[model samples]
Target: MTAAGMRARGNVRTLVLAGALVTVTAALGMVGCTLFQSEQVSKGQKLYAHYCMHCHGEHGQQNEGYNWGQMPDPRPKDLSNKGEMSTFKDEEIFGTISRDMKDTTPEVGDKIGDDEFAVPTMPTFKYTLSEEEIWSIVAYVRTLHGMKLTYNVEARKKELQDQLQTAQQKADQAKQALEAADKKAEDEAEKKGVEVDEAATAKEQEANVAAIKELEAGKTAFANFTARPKLAAVPRPDLTMAETEAAKLAETGKRLYGNKYGCNACHRVGEAGGLVGPALDRAGFRLNGTWVYRWIKYPQSMKPETRMPNLGISDQDAKAITMYLATLRAPKPEKPIEKAAH
Candidate 1:
């Protein structure tokens, strides 16, 4: 071949090589993105199972094996329903998950029986989970409705910073209000030529100081917050057991019921716990193990308006708690001596 022809061929080869490199790089980048998304979804699934599955169900439908018809007016929504879930934006869902949905005060006419207000049963997760964890959960929830995960970390961080600023401003305003109130009280007392109630003033001051401390602590927590991606380990409860295995499981349940889950907060076993719920001292005699297990797993399924929130108890944990509760039976009655003599 001529020298000019050979040069042209070499040029073509160079262009082809550059094209291949670009294609390969693009493919690798796509793969990396897919892997990252998969990891995020996996982390979310673990979190959902641990914290949300009890009420939201395994697939975001309501929990199984209960008469949902008997549930309260606004039962847990069908999260897996695409038509419903699609209407919600990612940020809106994230907000709902992070904040409490209950309405503390309702319109006077809207109030239900006895001073009770009908409100959503969903609880706040902001205290229990970090911002990143909540975003991950949002991503996972989207998957249930066949939606893609779309998260903007930088935008979210900016939003959080703005919120912190607003909170700081509110705290300053509250302090100013408290100070003004104190000064006004002192001036009025002086003008009236009467001494202010020292004890009442001291108590009010102490409460205000405590409130300020709490606000400061909350601000500190917000300022120092950072998102770190990590997968949580999901607990698997043991369910297969024989009658002989009851004692061992019961012991485990005792610890979980009394300490881990803080069941005693609302339930009374003997002389302890609050009066918010019924006493459980004779639960063994009154309740069945299977019934107890289901109740602990998801209480809303049985009684939609029950104050008990699902603690995401695993099957094993529920079983163990059931065994422990079963041990709280009343003592067997004694037979009469006259019947034995006859």
Candidate 2:
């Protein structure tokens, strides 16, 4: 064979081999991504089963206690319904699942505002799951409706940091302005030969210090958005037990109310408690059992601005307490003796 002919054949073979290697590498890369996504979705499924299945249902299509189409307003969404799920963006779904439903008063804003809805349909998962875990759930949710989702943690973290920085800057600016006002007031008091209200000044200083501390703490704590919740889960009581067991449950509930739950510290029950909270002496008659039960379990869920802390009362304990409270109806007023004269 000629030298040129041999050279041309060698070059063609080299080009073909190179092309084959490129194809194999690309295919392997795609397979690796698919495997990683499958793993993420699998982890998310487990989490959903544990945390979401109670209200969202076994397959995200049914609610536990209510009839599907006949339930009252603000019912759980059927997550397995493709037509309904398709309407939401991935970020929207993630935000709905993880973020607080109500708009808390921003540190920089003057006017108070709240969400337009009466009550949130779902509880916030922010206190429960890490950012990565929430993204996993989002991926799993896609599978429920036969879809796919990919999340960028770094990008979202950057966005959150940017927002926090802006709010912090505003807060710092407000603090400086407050300090300047305080200094000006002090100077005026000295110039006018008038005594400053030392108590008010001290209170103002304390408030300013608290605001600074909150800002500093927020930057460090919320940087990673993971939280260790103060309350622990307690077992729920069975409300449908036999009537013969009522006295035992009430006695246990009374003990919890006075000591373990510490209700008497803030609320009065037949004059044995403080005035920090309203008297619970007749709360059973004044309030409905269902409302009381929910309030004891999750106070801020019904009233967002409430100072009540979730004390992590067990479900069974709450039901027991409810039963005890229900027995405290006020005595009826006596009829007048004038009826005998009539």
Top model number, lDDT = 1
RMSD of each: 16.4, 16.4
52-163: candidate 2 lDDT, tens digit per residue? 6544666778644222232223556789899999988888788776654342224521233353222233445555466667788899989989999866654666766776
User: How accurate locally is residue 22 in candidate 1, as Cα lDDT from 0 to 100?
Assistant: 99
- The sequence of per-residue lDDT tens digits that candidate 1 reaches over residues 181-217 is 6787788889999886555456456656766776676
lDDT of each: 0.65, 0.64
Clash pairs detected, candidate 2 = 235-315, 236-315, 236-316, 237-315, 237-316
lDDT of 1 at 70: 27
Candidate 2 ranges beyond 4 A from true positions: 64-72, 103-119, 150-342
lDDT of 2: 0.64
